[model samples]
Target: MYDEFTIAAYERNGFAVIPALFSAEELEEIERQLEAHLRLDLASAPKGDVVFEADSERSLRCLFRIHERSVFFDQLMRDSRLIQLVRQLFNGADVIADGTMLIDKAPLTTYEFPWHQDNAYQFWNPPDAVAVTLALDDSTAESGAIVCLAGSHRESILPHQPSGVFGASRSLVTPPNADEYPPVTLSLKPGDVSLHHVSTIHRTGPNHTSKHRRNLGFAYHTSRSVCDNAAADQYKRDLEKFLQTQ
Candidate 1:
């Protein structure tokens, strides 16, 4: 359920978790589709194990072509419940498309997503681009969970060092001193959703669990007119091809 404080928290803290958003059936549906897509990719992957993990981070799979890969995910992409949440965050504007992807982080140690803003790879559109992360598993700091600095979205977009959406690191002016701020744990059960602004500073730690920790992130935007970056559109298209071939 959402509240005034919750909305305000997103405004002030840069991220807010809307609790108990997805039903049990909904979570199962997403997982079913995700696993199916993973298997399809595995079938055609090259010889030997294709660890699917982007980097040092362990992963069972990473997929972006949901429509081409799984009907279940395509259904969730336009699910009435998901659309409503997207509408609420983007101010009731119908989404032109769904993006980012369904990411699966497998259990391991010593992997962490360096801090970065979603908009860095994006068009740097302040307050326009948003990502809704749906938890398909319990999110704990040790399990490669999302963490963010509250109110960091208010700042300007920092130039990106450029990495895969799930693999790159953000260029920090000066890594935060120990006395600065500690990362916040985004603990959530399956079906919990967190909506974050594009400029919000965020990162996740390694998934220490042997079991997979999965999440489907819907990058919602009004339209390409709002994105204002042709190169990014190209990048997104390029990413889709990577998914289909994998």
Candidate 2:
């Protein structure tokens, strides 16, 4: 369960870890259900460089195609405990945009997620609220767990991205202001969770260990106050329909 402190931490830091939210056995089972499908998806993607970990024997990515694989993820997607949290944090009026098992942060030495926020996304009460990162495995700094800037989200909506060019997972910290952005490492084990605000500046680096640290990132949102820009409302009328065409 979460509390005022937990919510406040998330508000101030844009992220906070919730301890032991899933059983090890449950995680193991979920991974078992996801591994094969993920591997197959990775092998078939037209662009390998964009998705797979920069330098690791990573398998599949399910987030891109979760709606189609209903059998494997349907019940989990409909999880009441998860949905309840979304409603509580976003204060209801939210919906599940999408999700899938993000597997094998391929423990090696070269995987990292670039700094970015889902805030640009229009599916929620406002991306500024929060999203969920449910750990399916033990998450640690060395294992390529999430690292977040304390409260960058409340400031500028500037893209937390790199300049010059793109390469690997990058931090948005820049000169003269890098010190202004302090990042904290979140350590969590299976069953534990972390709530990251949309504007929460965050990223992950490659796993330096020999074992894969698999985690599932469950992204959520509430009906945004912004005007519906073209396909926005239409897409919500049928998330699956819109996705199938993609």
Candidate 3:
């Protein structure tokens, strides 16, 4: 549960970390189910509706439309605690999960997620959504835990260019300018969860340590937020093409 101080922190900084919100057992189940789902995704993706990362076929970058892929993820997105916190963030407005992603940073991986805003990729209107990153593995600074700007969401949407990651399109990337916002590391233990506004500037560094940095991410938006179907579709098509290159 969040206290007044925590709520104020979220309101002011556009991000907050709720520690140990989930139990260790729950985190284990999530990781187990995710591995199973990812195996299925890798085996039947592209030819099937599932998607993979842009660079490596074996890396398993993210599982999109995750709610439809498995009941566990569906339940997670609909979990009472998640909904309650999201509603509080949205000022009691009804919320819906617009998207879900399973991000994996393999041990000693060099994947660099340049600082960017979630809204830059999703292109949702009103940009009033919160993303929850639930750590399935211990995320430490050495293991490439996510770094965020304290209150960058309060600023206007900065200019975003193409990431040049082969399959990534202009809309798919927003490389961060580090000088604009101060960065703060959000180290998390398994079962810990961190939430950030859609427009909050954030990024994950490379995994220098020998531990997998796996996280289940959910994007929750109020029912009042509008979707740009055309933009979303284009991104999907671009992503699909990107996967084929791998």
- The TM-score-based order of candidates, best leading, equals 3, 1, 2
lDDT of 3 by residue, 157-209 (tens): 67766565422234224555557667889999998899999888877788898
Please give the range of 10 consecutive residues that has the lowest summed lDDT in model 3. 164-173
Q: Model-by-model lDDT, in order?
A: 0.67, 0.60, 0.77
Q: Estimate the overall C-alpha local distance difference test score of candidate 3.
A: 0.77
Say which prediction, candidate 1 or candidate 3, comes out ahead on lDDT: 3
Which residue window of length 10 is worst by lDDT in model 1? 162-171
What's the CA RMSD for each of the models? Answer: 4.7, 5.9, 3.0
For each candidate, how many residue pairs have backbone atoms clashing (under 3 Å)? 1, 12, 0
TM value for model 3: 0.86
The residue ranges of model 2 lying beyond 4 angstroms of the native Cα positions read 39-50, 53-63, 101-103, 120-125, 160-178, 225-246
Candidate closer to the true structure by lDDT (higher is better), 2 or 3: 3
User: For model 2, how does the per-residue alpha-carbon lDDT over 1-246 read when each residue is reduced to its tens digit?
Assistant: 357787677667777777876667877777777766565655554341224433354443224434355466656765777677666665566666455445457657564566765553333334534667777767899898888877777765553333212222223554224477698888878878888877777777778888767676666656654433653555344443433443
User: TM-score for every candidate vs. truth?
Assistant: 0.79, 0.73, 0.86
Backbone clash total for model 2 is: 12
